[model samples]
Target: MADSVGFIYTFFLTAAVIYVSAIVIIFGVKEQPIRSKEAKRVSYSRKDVLIHIFKQPLLVVTMLLTFITQVGNFSIQPLLALYIHDLHGPVNLAFYAGLAFSATGLGNLLFTRKWGDLGDRIGHDKVLLALLILSSILFIPQAMADSYVMLVIFRFLYGMALGGIIPCTTAYIRIKAPASMQGEVLGYNVSFRFLGNVVGPVIGGIVASHYGIPAVFYVTAGIFLFGALFLWAVRSHAKTNERSV
Candidate 1:
């Protein structure tokens, strides 16, 4: 037992040393030159920059959509295992739970690039609308899943739908934002995404505890549906050329 424990400790220590050594070596190398153009003198103050970002309806809408999607995406992760168990899944409950959890990632990985290319061909808004609606619809089966296999299959399909979201969002921002402000827009999008990640798990735990596991999926689906409706409204509003409605 002592030898086994020592081996495990030694393995971790070796990994740590290798990671640190790589970092040190990389840092020791000369840094690459910044290829992007340097900013010229500007009259804009900090407040002006803040106002500019806030004034752009497109940027605000993109960030909101990204946040909503992230919240919906992770909302079930904390409760997935418990939900499967509650459904009276197979005897190998742990294995199925792990499979269900991993299926989403596998599906996402397979579909991400294809969705990105599709968004590039079509408009981002159109792609976003489709993905949002499809993802919400896929969640219905998850909420009503009678077996572990069903849950995994639904989650996998949901993930494929989700895979398009970030790329399309980023592509939309790049297309809309000024070159100088694009980085700032992306940074804000990331901040909102992480905020969603932090908030999602807490909300999921509360909803599951109070309303049971299935309720979590129902609520998450509703949120995604709401996001789709909101996106539709924004797109419609953007298309109105007249000053008056």
Candidate 2:
């Protein structure tokens, strides 16, 4: 029976991979004619573009905020299953764990594009600030949640708030960064994100061991609030400079 189960699992996994690969091969290949248009838009050399991006206050601060927010967002990831257990979850702990984990993605998927559009219409920085504050508020309930259902609900809302932040940051970058270096700056943002992923769990584990799981949520909420304030300062400084000029 065990051998049969293993064989079936492997067979389905292999079939899924092949199916996805085929779809990608069929539909994913495209030649971008926009490359020429992009090149024509920016006359600066790559080195100059790099230096300009590095010197931009908005880009630097946005990247830092990205790092901080990602760290806070993912800090509780490794503890979610254990948290469910603490809540005295239903018999299928694994199922609840999966549900709690996926709830964030579902919320993110639903809200990301809407937030992106809103950012485009209004202002990315403003939208990002609002989302950060909202996310921080949502984390409070998550930290205090006593039931599995409540935890899932909070996670879902947290995810929705988080889903808006990254795209807003990206939109801000595009508006402020030199067109030639936008891709590189975005890549750096992604690196910061991964750096946060690396550090979040380690720091979370230490905090959880010392204080408790709930404390992790509290800490993350504080971090998000701090990041929002930092972004606000940066935005304010920019406006002040613009007015003075």
Candidate 3:
């Protein structure tokens, strides 16, 4: 599309779309008032916000999970083209890599809402567990992929799993935190995600350089498992604390 339309033109077109979106948001969307902890003060100091974030075990763990999840995602994506080559994919495997990337996005588009709905029906925690575990398992097959098509399929499935995570965490925060704290807590969550984005590719590149590209997938899967285990333990501990009290 960029080639057909000209890259420079596409860039401007995309900027225009974003500007229009921003205009719509500013003009069209009505934001509710913030009350209580947030509105009473100018802003929570960095230290105070950090303290509050750490005090909530569930939120802390969820933020950590978000970070780890992105680590896995970023780790694999930056080297997807190389993985396709190793799989003896099609001659246009470079293009196939892009396709593989888009596959995950398509899956996200198709299934994100379904995952959110499922989370609503069951529980966000369980939904989180399912997504993480399924994501972990999906990585193994991706590592073992014999063709680009197979890898693309796995990426799509993994994306489906990924889509629900943000929604679940957002919903969880809304239910668990005061409105004032919710915004800041979610801010920290996004910060964690950005941190993971920074770290994941470096880790992935290092693992690939030392162990081979397939090893990166195995390691990515392990990262996802670590998130699942961490969240599970936190949930268990919280439950135990509730029972004892």
lDDT of 2 by residue, 1-245 (tens): 22335556867888899999989988998756545567567776667766877777888888888889878977899988889989965567667787887899888999999999999998888899999999889999998998888999999998899889888888888888765667777888888988999888988899999999999999999989999898889889989999999
Residue pairs in collision within model 1:
none
Candidate 3 residues lying further than 4 Å off, grouped into runs, are: 2-16, 27-49, 88-94
* RMSD, every candidate, angstroms: 4.7, 3.5, 2.9
Candidates sorted by lDDT, best first: 2, 3, 1
How many residue pairs collide in each prediction?
0, 0, 0
- The TM-score ranking, best first, is 2, 3, 1
Models 1 onward score TM values of 0.81, 0.87, 0.86
lDDT comparing candidate 1 with the true structure = 0.82
The TM-score of predicted model 3 comes to 0.86
Write one digit per residue (lDDT tens) for candidate 3, span 95-207: 66668889999988998899889989999989998899999998899888887678878889888888898788878877766665667778878888999999999999999
lDDT scores for all predictions? 0.82, 0.85, 0.85
Better of 1 and 3 by lDDT: 3
